[model samples]
Target: MAYQTFRQEYLQVPPVTRAYTTACVLTTAAVQLELITPFQLYFNPELIFKHFQVWRLITNYLFFGPVGFNFLFNMIFLYRYCRMLEEGSFRGRTADFVFMFLFGGLLMTLFGLFVNLVFLGQAFTIMLVYVWSRRNPYVRMNFFGLLIFQAPFLPWVLMGFSLLLGNSIIVDLLGIAVGHIYFFLEDVFPNQPGGGKLLRTPSVLKAIFDTPEDDPNYNLLPEERPGGFAWGEGVSWNC
Candidate 1:
């Protein structure tokens, strides 16, 4: 009964969000069960290129430390913003969304070479939040029920919160950089005078991931509400 209900709800989540979030949760659970360790997950260039441990590239973005306050906080933000982006602006464009993921992950991996950061899941989360906020710049956001600001500042606000928590700001900054790069290339640059679309989703991805418009069985999710939340809605930070 409960399991059936849970399965139905889970299936309702947009495909990209469902797959990515499920991977993160399962990776964490693997760690919790002692089947995996952070040592095996953290990104290491030497192992990746020299010894060919390629899975670390993806796994590093999966584990967000142990299952506790920090884990829950990151997961909430990740799932929330990721889902909002998919069902809102990127709705019916699964291939492009997946392309964005590949693009952002590639940029982060390149940048990770110069930084001392281990895991990058938080940065990836920030990139999603950043992109969504840029697309919905007018939406008001409330941080911790205290500070209220426009959507554009949400990434910085999260960075500020990270600083307050004694976490390195580097990760947040990395996310913001990659997010800005993506937003500018995809949204801003193409609209400028004499500027053309710089980011194009490969046709292969489209063929593999995007559903055909002529398909009679295709069902699109309902359009998301403004800001991905109701007006006057409070986003509680339980940490």
Candidate 2:
């Protein structure tokens, strides 16, 4: 009975989020079981371009190390914000969400070529959080009950938290940069005087991922008001 309930709830997650999160989990599990090594998964340009190990491009963003605190933390944030974004602003736009994933992943891969960082899964998670926070700027968040701030600052706060954990901030910064570029292109710039849409979801993706639905009454989830709780300590808040 418990397993059945779990399966039902898991199946309820939006498609993109469910697939991405499940991939991350399974990839990490494969590593933990010694079915694969980090060398096969990390972003290595030489192995990818010369040896034709192109799978590295996507696998590099699938593993988040072995099962531990870092893995659980990243997985939680990844699942939470990814679901919120898919069900909130991108509710009816699965194709566009997929395009955003591709765009951000491609940009990060390009940046990875210059940097020595491996396993971009965490950065990708940060990008999701950053985008969601930007779109829901009015939502209030509490960080471990120690800090209270608006949504826009969530990404920076996570970066700061990473610093406190003795981890490199470069990954977080990269995610923020990519997230900002996406937000500016998709949300901010188009609203300015004489500005037009710069980032468009390719028709191929739309045809492949989107279904024809003409719901005149379709409405996005309403933004949650301020005074919501934090995401730390295993507590999550809706935004």
Candidate 3:
């Protein structure tokens, strides 16, 4: 049964596949162009006591890389998870994928600051993404190409990592909070029957501590939207 869902969700062309492809290309470019330099990563080349650059907050994902086995492993994960989330099988609410990529990157940067290290910071940020994807209800992914299986504990596994690392706990938690608020605002304001002045909602402004929950992402996007199925007419993911 799970295998069937996996095949359906990940096999063929997931809705966000194109986005995933773009992510991979950018990552490769960053690495090849030497743009993924450590000196340029944190906006603090010397690693001395200095303030954040603000730009690195979002530019660092383009710098993701690891030596030897870790590099290939995470690169595969980047491809795998991004593929599912981009596929649009979840049939999510308005432009969820776009927001996930954009804001998620920012959240990662904020996490990096407390981590006091660019690598660790990005790691936690990626973990937050997977956790957010897991929290999305009634959604799952199956990987047949390399990772073939089902998982109900994506969020727990991620949180568990966060728990084990005491050095990174404080900032990591903050990143989680940031991601949660983003999800809530996206789902809530517009979800309110008949759209009003969503730009001025209390939740968007305050970002107050709430239930500590965010939208769990999945291999698919909102089915209600037009792009949910078969590449939205002439568009083809295989390309």
How many pairs collide in each candidate, listed in order? Answer: 0, 0, 21
Model 2 C-alpha lDDT per residue in residues 40-141, reported as the tens digit of each score? 899999999999999999999999988999999999899999998887778778999999999999999998888889888999999999998877666678
Index of the highest-lDDT prediction: 1
lDDT of 2 at 108: 92
Instruction: Name the better of 2 and 3 by lDDT.
Output: 2
* Candidate 1 structure lDDT: 0.88
The regions of model 1 sitting more than 4 angstroms off are 213-239
In order, what is each prediction's RMSD in angstroms? 3.5, 4.1, 11.8
Q: CA lDDT of each candidate?
A: 0.88, 0.86, 0.47
Q: Which ten residues in a row have the lowest lDDT in candidate 1?
A: 230-239
Candidate 1 TM-score, C-alpha based: 0.90
Q: How far is candidate 1 from the true structure (C-alpha RMSD, Å)?
A: 3.5
**Per-residue CA lDDT of candidate 3, range 36-115, in tens?**
66556543433333554655554455454544444554565556555554534333322445445556655555555555
Candidate 2 off by > 4 Å:
213-216, 219-239
List of clashing residue pairs for candidate 2? none
